[model samples]
Each structure stands twice: as C-alpha cells, then as structure tokens.
Target: MSAPTLYELDPADSGIYRAQMVTLTDKNPYAASVYVYDEDEYRTMRLLVTDDGKAGVALKGDEIVSVFAHKDCAHPKSVQSMLSQATALGGRRLDCFDTVLPDLYADAGFVPVARLRWNDDYAPDGWDYETFRTYNGGRPDVVFMAYDPDRVGGDYTPGVGEYVEDYDDGIARAQRYRPS
Candidate 1:
C-alpha cells in the first residue's frame, strides 16, 4: 500500500478534525478530549489529519502543553511525521502518554517521566483508583513521557486550558489508550 499522506488542517476548520477524533472514542476513550483547548488562551492548535490517522498539538511559544495521536494513525511513520511537524512549529517540550506510540516516542528521544497506574501500589498523587479504573477502561498502566527534558521539564500534570478532567480527582485530564 502507498504511504498515508498528512494534511495540516486550518485552525478555523479544526472542527472537522475534532469530529473525526470523537468518532474514535468508542474504541479509543482518549479520543474524547485529545483536541480540547481553552477558548480564552492564546493557544493555536495545529491539527494534522490523514486518510487513516490524525494528530493534534497545542503550542504555547516553545512548550507543548497538549499533544495526542489518533489511534488509527499512531504508527511509526505517521507518528514521525506528526512529531516532525510539531518540532518544526516550535514545539520544544512534549508531554504525552505512552499508551499508543511508546516505542516510536522512545525512538525519537523521549523518556518516561511518570507512570499512571490504577493500582494503589503505584498510583500518582491524588489519583482516584476506582475512577481511574473506570475512566481508563481497564488499561492498567499509562506511562507519561517527555521529549527534550533538559530544555523542558517532563511534568505530566495538566495545566489550565490544556487538558480537561471530567472526573473530580487527579488522574490525567485527557485519557489515553484502550486496548483493541
């Protein structure tokens, strides 16, 4: 098969990308909030769409506050394309979960900074085990990784206008990964 082509969607037309991402939520729960961005912030989200995949990123100056890849397009090449585009657009620091493209991210110089586990033995601070179990949909461990830690810190904690936490507790605001 031919390689999938990536297209950069206009910010004004990002609704279409959001709609597509929502459709994937049935199988990939993380898709529900992958592209959620605060309206008040001066954040410009660059969403890259493909025939079989998609990726969304929000860059505030050089820091990447939010980033996610559509389940369908989380493969090596597609992910490489997404990362390349993000880097070119001034995303120096990336904080994302390793639920999807863990190997790819590692190959690209990302290191694990935190691990989110539903198990009480290793759960992060303020994590509601039962709530995370439900929200995570049986995915036991979600590893948080960061790229370029020397320049940008690998803090997985959500910031304002970045990730929306539907639950009342301190699990990841935007969920990632549901096994197929």
Candidate 2:
C-alpha cells in the first residue's frame, strides 16, 4: 500500500496534529480538549485537566490518559513539570517524541527509544506542501521517549545515545520499534 496520508492540507486540513501548539478554547483549566496526531499518526482528542490541582493530558474525555503533573493548568513546558503531570495522571506512560531535548526526557523517567529523521524545510512557503511531502523523509523530528516509572525522579543513563546520524541505521532502528 502507499504511505498513509502524512497530512492533508488546504480546504480540509485534516491529519495534521500539533499538540505543542494546542490552546484550549478558553482559560478554563478544568478541562481543555484538543485534537493532535500522536507520534504514530493516530488521531486523538487529548484532554488537559486540573481537577486534582495538577495539569495532565488524558485520552478518555477528561480522564488522565497520560502525562500529568503540577502544571500551570495553562501551559506547562518543563520536563520536570511533565514528570509531575505524568505521575499525577495515575502512572500513565509518557510515550512521545521531543525535538527539543532528549537528555532532559531521559532524566524525566523516559528512555530514548528511536531517533527521528526529518529533513529541514519540509514545510515550504507558497502552499507547496505536495512538493515538500513528496521528498519528505518519514522519520520523526524528535527521539521517541517512553516513560520508565521505576526510573522516575532518578538519574538513569540511557542505553543508547541520542542523535542517530547514520541514515540507514536510523531507518532500520526506527522501523524495528515503530514508536509512536
């Protein structure tokens, strides 16, 4: 089969999910709903809540699906903040990719899973999305991280280092896990 639709631009800008850019409808911290594409391309409506005085993302309608902590109930950015959120979310795993910092993710009880490999300038101007995607590398832009609860609040060295430079190796390793 052909590649799954990486994204659908234009009149029906479907399949493009950007959680980092999510902003709730209002300042209501009690419940915030957002639709974002998980690392695996699965479309999901992530819910952010603060009923328990901690900011967390959940899957099932305001329920803590995963990733929660003592957040601002507004927008949390720190890895430690995320860790606290995850723990508060009732032990849900933090399985996601971070283009910013893999080392910091490791410190937050996440294991560096796979290194993403996406080309620069993938999204060009002038509505040239087709051209960009045609040559777009399927690799993610960040390393996939999986929470290791036992390793939380502790300094644990990742089994493998970050930044997979070899193109072939990157593809192979990524394929093996197909991390989301």
Q: Model 2: which ten-residue window has the lowest total lDDT?
A: 1-10
Number of the top lDDT candidate: 1
Candidate 1 deviant stretches above 4 angstroms: 1-6, 29-43, 51-77, 98-100, 113-144, 148-180
Tens digit per residue, CA lDDT, model 1, 63-142: 45444555455453455555556666765444433344455555544454445443445444344334435445534445
Number of colliding residue pairs in model 1: 0
C-alpha lDDT of all candidate models, in order: 0.46, 0.39
Per model, state how many residue pairs clash.
Answer: 0, 5
Every model: Cα RMSD to truth: 10.1, 12.9
> Model 2, range 63-96, lDDT digits (tens) per residue?
2233433335444444365444544554333333
Give the runs in model 2 whose Cα sits over 4 Å from its true position: 1-21, 24-46, 52-54, 59-99, 121-141, 154-180
Cα error of candidate 2 at position 40, Å:
16
Candidate 1 pairs with clashing backbones: none
Best by TM-score: 1
